[model samples]
Target chain A: MREAYHDQLGELAEQLASMCGMVGDAMELATKALLDTDLAVAERVISDDAKIDDARARTEEDAYSLLALQAPVATDLRTVLSVIHAAESIERMGDLALHVAKAARRRHPQPVLPEAVRGYFAEMGRIAVDLARKAEQVIRTQDIDLARVLDDEDDAMDDLHRHLFSVIMAKDWEHGVPAAVDITLLGRFYERFGDHAVSVAKRTVFVVTGKMPGYSSDATDL
Target chain B: MREAYHDQLGELAEQLASMCGMVGDAMELATKALLDTDLAVAERVISDDAKIDDARARTEEDAYSLLALQAPVATDLRTVLSVIHAAESIERMGDLALHVAKAARRRHPQPVLPEAVRGYFAEMGRIAVDLARKAEQVIRTQDIDLARVLDDEDDAMDDLHRHLFSVIMAKDWEHGVPAAVDITLLGRFYERFGDHAVSVAKRTVFVVTGKMPGYSSDATDL
Candidate 1:
């Protein structure tokens, strides 16, 4: 029974890593579709959302079955709980991507954003994808080093967010408004994506160290 | 053991209801601050986020303890799961409210919306508060009647959102970009508040009925 339990746990973690990869790829595609005014890719991103929804449902089911069938405890329990939360966050991130894609489809052929705001969006997209990748990395390798770096990764996303706001509010404000709103929503999505990724890392921390991360209310502050 | 289990469940339900009430009040204050342009009240709303954060943490702790201690099954397990997800949606709704309150504070003496835009804002605000209150009703009563109608309630919010967008874009194109970016942000917040409130209602439906309201996802439609 113990061996079976370990095997099940290993399988679930691998599946979770794959889901993160797929969701991250979807987000990258959605971002490109938005920036390049690529209707075909925009349509493709939106059309392919079922992939995300299916993965999300499966992830939730895996966690539930692990809890009910295997009755995971201690580290295993943390993994399941964190999986549930992370799955929800990734699904929502997918939705955000789909949202941007639909908007892109609607406003086809629009010019790319002005430079300052464009930089913010690109940086946000990169950080979001990296955070998702790092989550999978920590999961596969159980790397304490990767877990420790998550906060710094999230901080960078936040810095980009604050800068996007400042640029919008500056003298070039009008130049940034449309791009700013788009960037703001993108930042919110990416920041939140980074946050959920951190939750996975913290769960790793807890599993490896038997300590819940600090902060009484650190849900998605991840 | 069963009686103690019942007692713990009751406590959890009560706490969830309390959290729901706070979220409802947060939505109320968000719109009220907008309508009145009361920066002090908005500041208060932002400052008081800790209360909502505390409630969220307590809800999670209670849910986790209930599951780990009681080892509930079937319907009981669903009940715990519902509480966990509801608290999550509530946390996000609080964050949405904070987003609006923060925007309001930034626009101290909030920029006056056009009369037409104000009317739309009022309509959106009313619908948001109504949906939030209905969430409380479902939590307290487990009223499937009320819970299912959330689709309709959300339709109203969606309608208001669509109407607001038309005005914003049309005015921008015709009259050349009038309202402050802050108002735009406020509108986005209210729209999102309604979305999360509907999410809470959907969770209620799952808890009570054991079915995940299978509204097929087109992702393109989002």
Candidate 2:
């Protein structure tokens, strides 16, 4: 009973990791859609929402079955519960990516943001994909150390976020109303996207360490 | 053992409900700030983020400790996890409230949205408060019927959201771009706030039903 339970539980774990992998891929596509003004990619991400929704359901079911049948105790039970909660977090991340994708669609042929500021978004996209991939690695290998490093990556994205904001604010006064609104909304969404990735990282730490945040509880000190 | 667990878990449930109540209050003040151009209220919501963050943390710790201590099964386990998850969602709702607050701060007092449209935001706020209150009542009484009704409230919010967009698009084409961007972002954040409230309602269903959305088997949807 124990072995069979562990096997199904492991299967659930692998499924979650793969879901992370898909979000990583989706993030890549989202950024590419932004850069290339590719409607196809944006549409794909939009349609993929149902897919993420489905994964969430399955993980919840798997978690339930494991608990009901195996009746695990102590640390093992915490681990299972953590993974289930973590799955929900990742689903939200995917949902946010789709929101970004929809934003991309709304912004057809993509007006160019200031070049210096554009670099910040590029860096944010990079950090996001890395965070997603790191989340996958953390789940598959249960690597706490790598998850800790993802912690710093969140800060880097945050810096980029602040930088983008200051630049946009400086431009807002000069560029008039339309520019101000665009920069504000764009920067806002980008900053929030970084927040979602950080959330995924936080959940990864929780799953591996049985702690809300592995090393630092205050990831949003900025 | 079961009785002792219930006592501990009951407190957690109350905290979860309290968190939602706080979010609902913040949302009400945020909409008032936006509609009335009350910078003070906007500033209040921004400063109130720490309170929301604290609520989220305290509620989360409560849920985690219950799971760590009680060894709850089936519905009980689901309830604990769902509350933990709902706290996170409620926190996000607070974040959206802050989003509107920031947008309000950026705008000058003059040139408010039309009366009919402002009514939509007001209605949205009331519905949000209602759904949140319903969820809280369900947690308090374990009334599945109340939870079920809140679940339906999500569809209502979706419909209202569509109306919001059309209203904005109509005014934009009709009134021209004068004050368009601010109104657009305001509408956007209001819709998002409603969406998060719907998410909390969905978790309430999870707590009661043990049915997690069941979207697809092969999709790995997340």
Which candidate comes out best when scored by TM-score? 1
Error of 2 at A148 (Å): 3.8
Task: Rate residue A151 of model 2 by lDDT.
Answer: 74
- Give all candidates' CA lDDT scores: 0.72, 0.69
True-vs-predicted CA distance for residue B22, candidate 2, Å = 2.0
Candidate 1, A189: how far from true, in Å?
3.3
Per-prediction TM-score: 0.89, 0.75
Query: B37-155, model 2: which lDDT tens digit per residue?
Result: 89898889889988988989888767767776676777887777778777877887777777766766766475356665777777776777677677667667767666657656655
**lDDT, candidate 1, B126-156, per-residue tens:** 8877888888888778888887687687777
| Candidate 1 deviant stretches above 4 angstroms | A73-75, A112-116, A172-184, A214-222, B110-116, B172-180, B216-222
Worst 10 residues of 1 chain B by lDDT: B213-222
Docking class of 1: acceptable
At residue A180, what lDDT does model 1 achieve? Answer: 49
Output the number of the DockQ-best candidate: 1
